[model samples]
Target chain A: MDSLDDYQIPYGLMAEFDTPADAMHAAEQVRDAGFTRWDVHTPYPVHGMDDAMGLGNSKVGWFTFCCGLCGFFGGMLMIWYMNAYDYGIPVGGKPNFSPFASFPVAYEMTILSGAFGSLFGMLFLNKLPRLHHPLLKNMRFADVTHDKFFVVIEADDPKYEEEETRALLKKAGSKHIELVNE
Target chain B: MANHSVPSSVKIAPPPEELERPALVENNRSLGWISDTVAGVIENKTPGWWKLTFGISLLVSLGLPIGLVYLISTGVGVWGLNHPVAWGWAIVNFVWWIGIGHAGTLISAILFLLRQKWRTSINRASEAMTIFAVMCAGIFPAVHVGRIWFDWWLFPLPNANSIWPQFRSPLLWDVFAVSTYFTVSVLFWYMGLIPDLATMRDRFRKVAGKVVKPAAKMRNKLAQFLYGLFSLGWTGSNRHWRNYEKAYLLLAGLSTPLVLSVHSIVSFDFAVSQLPGWHTTIFPPYFVAGAVFGGFAMVMTLMIPLVSLYKGLDEIVTIRHLEVMSKVILVTGSIVGYAYGMEFFIAYYGGNPYELYAFKNRAFGDMNWSYWWMIGCNVLAPQFFWFKWCRTTPWFIWVVCGFVNIGMWMERFVIVVTSLHNDFMPGNWGYYSPSWVDMITYFGTFGFFMTLFLLFCRFLPLIAISEVKGVTPQADPHHPLGGAKH
Candidate 1:
C-alpha cells in the first residue's frame, strides 16, 4: 500500500524525563538531529514541542478554509442549478441566480465543510482509526497520561539505530530509556 | 489583615463570604438575607415561584417519556399538522432552542477572547444554559419526520438501504450544521468542565468522611470515565495547560462562525419558501440576531437569581459582570430591532402586492397587537439599558431581560401564525391558533429546558470553578490580563 499508513514505524524507543523542560529539550534534539519518523509522548501535551520537533504549522486550517470556500460555491451552484435552471419557478422577477436566497445554504455549507474538513483532514493526515497503536502495547505508555514525560524514536526514522538512539536519548537528559518492539 | 496588606483600592473585599458561591445549593434556593436569612433560605425550603417553575418543568419532562412514547406509538401525528406547515412547533422550537444555545457560547468564548474579567461568575451558568438548550434544540428535528423511529436517516452517507439521504434538502443541511454545532459545543463545554468536576470529586472525597464504602465506586467510576473520555487525560500541569489552552483557543475560533452558521441555516427553513412573508433575504441575520438577544436575556435572568443565592457573587460575578451583559443585551437587541425595520423597508421597496400586504397586515391587521407587543418587549424594553441605574439594578435588569425573551418568542409567533393566516388566496386565508397540544407542548419545552438546567445547577459544577480560579490573582491574577505581558 503506497500510503502514509504504509510508512509504518514498527518498533519504539522510549525516554523519560521528570521535568517537562528537559523532555521538550530531548524532543528538539531528536528532531533537529534529522529524525522525521518520531513522536513525543508526555503525561500531557507539551508547549513549543511542535516547533522543537520540527513540525510545520498544521495544514488542517488550510484544508478547512479551502473546503469552506468550496462549500460556499457548491451551495450557490446547487441552489442555482436546482431552483433556477432545473425547476424554473418564477414568482418575482428576481434573478434565477439569486445570491440572497443562496446565502443560507452557503452559510450552512461553509460550517459543514469547515467542521468536517478539520475533523476528517486531521484523521486522514494523522493516519488514524487504526484501532490500536504500538504505543498501546507498552505498559509504560499508561503513565503518559499522568505524572511523567517520554519521547519515542520510531525504528522507521532513517537515523534509527537501537544503540545510537539510546546513547543519543541519554545524552539529551533522559533519566530512563527503554526499547519497545511490536 | 490578609486582605488589608494590599493597597486600599487594589483589594476589594468580595461581598461577605456567604454571598460568593456561584449558585444556591438545593437547601438555600429560597429568597431573603436577614440575620437568620441563611437559616431561612437553607432550611430545605424552596421559594414559591421557583418551586412552581421547577415543579411544572419536572412534570413536563416526566411527561417527556410519555411524549416520546406517544410519538413512537402514534407517529408524528401526536401533534397537529397539515401541508403548508408540515414542520410546525418542532421546527420553531428547534431553531428557538439552538438560538438559545448561543448566549452561553458567546459568554464563554467571546468574553474569553476579549478578556472580560466579569464573565467568570456567569459563564458557568451560561454554559449550562447552552448545553441544556442545545439538548432541547436537538430534539425537534429528530421527531419532525413522520416516522421518527428511523431518525438515523438524517445521516451523511449511503446506508444499508442503499438510498443516501438527499444532500440537496434544506432539512438535511440543517441536520449536518446542527449536529456539528452540538458536537463541538458539547466538546467545548465538557473539556472546560473536567477540571472543575475533578475539583468537586476531590472536595466530595474529603467531605465524605472516613470509611465511606470505598467512595461510591460506581459513581466515581462514571465521573472518572466521563472525565477521562472528555479531558483526554488532563493533569493541569503548565506544560499540559499550554496545549490545552491552545486547543481551547482553536476550538473557540472554530465555534465562532459555527454559531452564526447554525442559526442562519435554520432560518433557511422559512426563507427558501415563497409563502409571502416567509420568503425574504432578511430572515437569516434577523433570526441569528434575535437568537442572541433572547439568549443573553435568558443568561442574565438565570445568573442574577443564582449568584444572589450562591455565596460568592462579588468576586466571581461582580456588578461589573451584570453591566457587561447589559451591554451585550443592548447590542443584540438593537440588531434585532434593525432587522425588523429592514423587513418593513424591503417589503415596501419591493412593492410586491402580497409581500407588501403581508407586512401591512402584520403591522395594522388583527395580529397588529402582538407585533407591537414584540416591538415593545424586544426593542423598547432593552433601551432602558441606556441608563446605568437600570443596568446595575439586578431587579431592573431581570425585568427587562424577561421582556426581551417574551418579545423574541412573540417575534417567532408573529412570523409563523400571521404569515400563514392570510395567504395570497383570500378564500384560503384564515387565522391559526395553537390548540391545547400546542400551548402545552410549548410550556413543556420551557419545563424541559428548566428541568435540565436545575439538575445541572444542583449536580454539576455550575460555575467554572477552575477557570474562575485560574483568573483570580490568587491563581495568577497579578499577571496582566490574558497574560499579554507573557
Candidate 2:
C-alpha cells in the first residue's frame, strides 16, 4: 500500500466543549448550518439535545410493538397446535385449547420477544457493535465518557469547508478543536 | 453544576430547601467524579474483607454442583421429597429464590419507567443480584425433573417419542416464564452496562499510562479490549442515546408485566391444584407481594454492607434510599399480612370445613411454629421500620431486613409444605422435614449467589455510572430549566 500520509482521507473535525450547553448550542448551530452527518457526544444524555440536533422521535417502540403482537398470537398458536390439534390429551377432562389456561405462557412469550426486538432494534438503528469508529482513533476522544462533550462534523457532509467549519466551531465556544484522521 | 438560572417569564424558583425533589445522590459530585468513584472500586486492590468473604463464598459455592451431582447420581430420593410431600425444599427454595429475584426488576425496570432517579445508584448491583438469584432458582427445577439427563423433555422440540410438555400445566408456564425472565433481565442489565463499560474502558487506558509493570500494562490492555468489545464502541453520540433511551423504555415496559406474571404463574403452580389450602384465588397477588417484600429485604441485606465497604458509596447510596426501600418493605409486608388474615377470614366466611380446617391447621397444627415464625419475621419485623430510627440506622435496618429475608423463606415453607402435608384424606397426611442433602443444596445456593455477587462487586461497576450522572442536575446544562436556549 502507498504511504498513509500521502493519501487524502479527511475523516472529520472534532470540537470539544466544557459543558453540555456549549455542545447543545454547537449542535443546534451545526444543524441549522444544514450538516446532516454530524453528532454530539456527552458523558450522559443531555436533555433537549435531541431537539438541538433536530433528530426525530426514535422508531424503536414500533419494532417492540410489532414483535409483541406477533409473540402473543404465536404463543397461543403454538399451545393450540401442540395440545389441541396435534396430540389430544384428556387430562383433567378440560378442553385442550383453553385460552384461560394458555394466557400466562402467551403473556411471557410476548414480553420475551418484545424485549429482544427493542434491544436489537436500538442496536440496529444506532449501527452499534461497530467496535471501531474514526473518532476512537484520537485518545482525547475517550473523554466523552467522562467530563467532556464534543461535536463532530464529518468531512463527508456536503457543506463541510475546512476553514469555515473550524471558525464556526470556535465561535460556538469550543475549547479545543482537532482535525480527526480517517 | 450546570446552569440553573431560568427565564423571567417562567415560574420563579422557590427557596432551595423547598425544592420539589431531594437530591438522589448527595455531595453534588461531577460527572467525572461519579465515574471515577465507581471505576475506582474495580481498579483498586481487593480489600482484605472482600477477599475473606469471597473465599468463604467460593468454598460454599462448590457445594452447589456437588449436591446436584450427588442428587443426580443417587436419584431424587437423595432429597427429602416423598409421598404426600413430593415437592420438598427444592420447590420451596425455587419459589423463594425466584421471588427474591423480583426486586431487581422492580428497581431497574418498573422504577425506571416511573422515573425514580434514586434507582440508578443501586440498580446495577440489584440487577446482578437478580441474575444470580435466578441462576440459583433454576437448579431446583432442573434437578427436580427425576431423570436429570432428560430435562430436555421440558422443551418442545421435535422428538422421536413425539411427547410434548403439558400445555395446561402451570409448571409448563413456569418453564417459559423463567427462561424469558432470565433472558430479558440479562439483556436489560447488559444494555444498561454499555455506557459504563465505555467509561471503564477509558479508565483502564488512563491507568495504563501510569503502570510500571509490563504485566500490569498488558492486563490493562486486555481489560480495555474486553470493555471496548462489550461497550459496542459507544461514544455517547446523541443519535445513539436517543435510540438507546427509547429501547430502554420499551424493555422496561415489557419487563413490568413479566415481573408480575412470573410470580403469579408460580402461585398458579399451587392455586391451580385441587387442595383446599392451595386453591385460593388470593395466592397470585399474595405471592407477588411476598416476593417483592423478600426481594427488598435481600436488597437491603446486600446493600447495607456493600455501601459501607466501598468508599464514596455512602454519598451515592444515601440513607434516604434505604429509608424508601424500608417503606416499600413495610407496605408489601402489610399486604402479605393482610393476605394471611383474609385467608382465615374467607375460610370461615365461606363456611367450608375443609378450608377452615386447613387455615386452623396452619396456625395451630404441628407446623404452627413455622407459621408463627413466618408471621413474626415478615409481618412483625418490618413494622419496626415505621419508626424513623429503625429505618435510618443502617445496622438496625440490616438486622430487621435479615429477619424479613428469613421470614420470606419460611413463608414459602409454610405455603409449600403446610399446604401439601395435610389434605382431605387424613390417612394420606404426613409431616415433611428436610434431609441433609436438602439442607446442603439450599446452603450451597447461598454460596452460589454470594460468589457471583462478590465477583460482580470486584469487577463490574456496582453503581450505574452513566445513569447516576444522567440524574444529577449538572447533566442538564440548564438545570432548573429555562436558561439555555434551544
Candidate 3:
C-alpha cells in the first residue's frame, strides 16, 4: 500500500514516552518486538535515532562538494581557453599559456559551484518542488511541525496484525492515535 | 460583546522612548544620569578631533582639484609614467581603495542577510565607509587614461566609428564591473539611510528646542530640510518601513553579485595577463578574500572605539559583535592562507618556470621583506583570533586589526609591485615606488575616508538609534516569563 498505516500493528503495542529516555527505551522495545516498519518523530532532536532506526548518514554534502568542484574547473577552462589559448595577447610580456593568470575567474567558479551545488543538491535529494504530497494531506501530520511527537508503525511491518497492534499501542502508553488515511 | 470583544476602555500605556529614558527609569534621581548623560553627549556638538579631521580632509579634497588642474594643464607628462608600468599609482590606488570598500558592504549586506543581529550598531558607520571609500575609488580610473576627454571609449557601445570594446579585455570588463558596483553601492547606501533619515527627522521635529546643541540650530534645521527632501516627509508608519524594507531587499539582491564581480574583474586585470605571479587561477578568490580581509580590518579599526564612545549604543554594539567580526576575519584569513597553499602546490606541481620564479622572487627576492610582512599580518595576525584574549579584548583586537590592514595593504602592494617590476623577461625588470605626489594622494584618500567617517560618527546618529532600539531586549528580548516586552 502507498499509505504507511495501511499495514498494521501488534496488540496493545504503544510507542510511548514522557522523556527522551523513555522514548528511547520504548523504541528499543518496539524494535525488538519485530516492529520493523515504524518511524519515530520527536519534539526535539534525540541523540541516537540513526542507530535506533538503522539509517545511514546522508549523502547530501558530498553531492554539494562535487558540484563546487565542477564550478571551479568550469571557470578555469573558460578563461584559460578563451584568453591564453584561443586568442592569446602578449600584454606586458605575459606568456599566452599563463595558468597563473587564469585564477581569479576560476575562483569565482568555485564559489558559484559550491553555492549552486548546495542549492540544487538540497532540492534534488529532498525531492522538492512536488506541489503536493501524500503526507502533508493529513491534518494530524500537519501538527507534527509543532509541539507533537509521533511513532508510526506501518501495516507492512513483519509483525503487523491489526488487533494486536492496537493493544500493543495501548500497552505502550501512546497518548492517542486516530487512523490517518490517504 | 461590547466589553470583552470591543476591548477595554483603559488606554494601554505606551512605553518610554529610550532604554535610559523609560518611564520607570526616569523621575528617579539616580537614573537621571542615563538620560542627562546621553543628552549631554548628543548635545555637545561635533568634538575637536572631528573638526580637526574635517579641516584636514577638506584641505586634502582641495588637493584633488589642484592635482586635476595640474594634470589637465601639463598633460600626462606631469606625472611619472614609464615603459613597463603602464598602470601606475592612480590605478593602484583605485584598486586598493575599492578593495578597502569591500568590508563595509560585506558587514552590512552579507552579514545582515545572514541574520547577524549585532551588525546593527556598526552597520551604519560601515555602510557610510562603503559610500565614502567607493567614492574615492570611483575617482581614480576616471582620470587614469591620458585623454580624460576620451575615457568614454571604455564603454561597451556597438557603434560604427571603430568597433565593440574588447570583452576579452579585463580593462573593458572592469569598466562594466566597477560602474555597476558604484551604482549599486550608492543605491544600497541610500536605501539604508532613508529609514534612519526619517528617524533623525522625527527626532529633530520632536526636539526642535533642544536641537541648538550638537549643531547650530542651522545645521539641525538643514538636516530636517534635507531629510524632508529625501524622504518626502516619511511618517514612520508600518507602511513606510514595509516599502522601505522591500526596496532594501532589492538593493541587497543587486549588490551581492556586484560585490563579487567588482573584485573578480579586478583580479582579472592581473589574472588575465600572462605575468608569472598574476596568471594563477587562485587570484580571483585570493584577491576577494584579501579585499574583504583588509576592509574588515579597516572597519574594526574605526568601529571598536566609536561604538564605545556613543551612549546606550554599547548595549547594542556589544562585545559579541566584535567577537563575531573577528571570527569572519579568522575565516577569510584562513581562506587566503589556503589560496596561498594552492598557489604553492600548483606552482611546483605544474612545473612552469616563469610562474615558479615569480612566486619565489616575491618571497625570497630583493623585496622579500614586504612579502614576509604580508604573511605576518595576513596569515599570522589573524591566527590570534583562535585565542579568547585576542578576540575578546578591545585594545588587543584593534592592534591586531591594524596589523591586518597593514598586511592587506602590503598584500596588494606585493601583488601589484612584484608582478609589474619583474615579469617573464629578465632584462625588462625594474623598480617602482610612489613619488611624493603618489604618496600624498594615497594618504589624501585616507584623509578623505577618515574625514567622511569621522563626520558621520559625530553628526549622524553614530549608532543607528532606531535600529539599535529595534534589537534591544526592550524590542524582542527572549522572554521565558512573558510574551511581550518586559
Give the winner by DockQ: 2
- lDDT by residue for model 2 over B1-486, one digit each (tens)? 013334566775445776558777787787788988889899899999999999999898888888888998989898888889998899999999999999999999999988888999999999999999999999999989889888888888867788777888889999999999999999999999999999998888766779889998898989999998999999999999999999988999999989999999899999988888899999999999999999999999999999998899999999999999999999999999999999999999989899898889999999999899999999899999899999899999999999998899999899888888898889989999888888888999999899899999988999999999888877877764322444
RMSD of each: 10.8, 2.6, 17.0
lDDT by residue (B1-486, candidate 3, tens digit) is 112222555555545557432212112222123223333345476677667767987887666666666776667655555656556777777877888788887877777777665776677778788788888887778876768877776763335564434334677667656765665566566655554554455445445667556646887688667754564433332222333444444345435665777798899888877788888788878888888988888888887876566655454556777887899899999998888778878988889988888788889987788899989999999999999878889889999999988887777777877767778887997776565666566667777777777766665555554444444332221221111221
Model 2 Cα lDDT, one tens digit per residue, A21-111: 7788788788888898899998888888888888889999988999999999999999899889898777867898999888988998899
Better of 2 and 3 by lDDT: 2
Q: For each model in turn, which proportion of the native inter-chain contacts is also found? A: 0.05, 0.75, 0.01
The docking quality of candidate 2, as DockQ, is 0.61
lDDT of 1 by residue, B123-206 (tens): 767888888888887876776676875788666344675544444556766776787777767767776765554344333333
Assess the local accuracy of residue A110 in candidate 2 as a C-alpha lDDT between 0 and 100.
92
Candidate achieving the largest lDDT: 2
- RMSD from true fold, candidate 1: 10.8
C-alpha TM-scores of all predictions: 0.68, 0.97, 0.65
The stretch of ten residues in a row with the least summed lDDT in candidate 2 chain A is: A1-10
What value does the lDDT take at residue B138 in candidate 2? 95
| Cα lDDT, all candidates | 0.67, 0.90, 0.63
Worst 10 residues of 2 chain B by lDDT: B1-10
Candidate 1 is scored at a TM of 0.68
lDDT of 3: 0.63
Q: Rank by lDDT, highest first.
A: 2, 1, 3
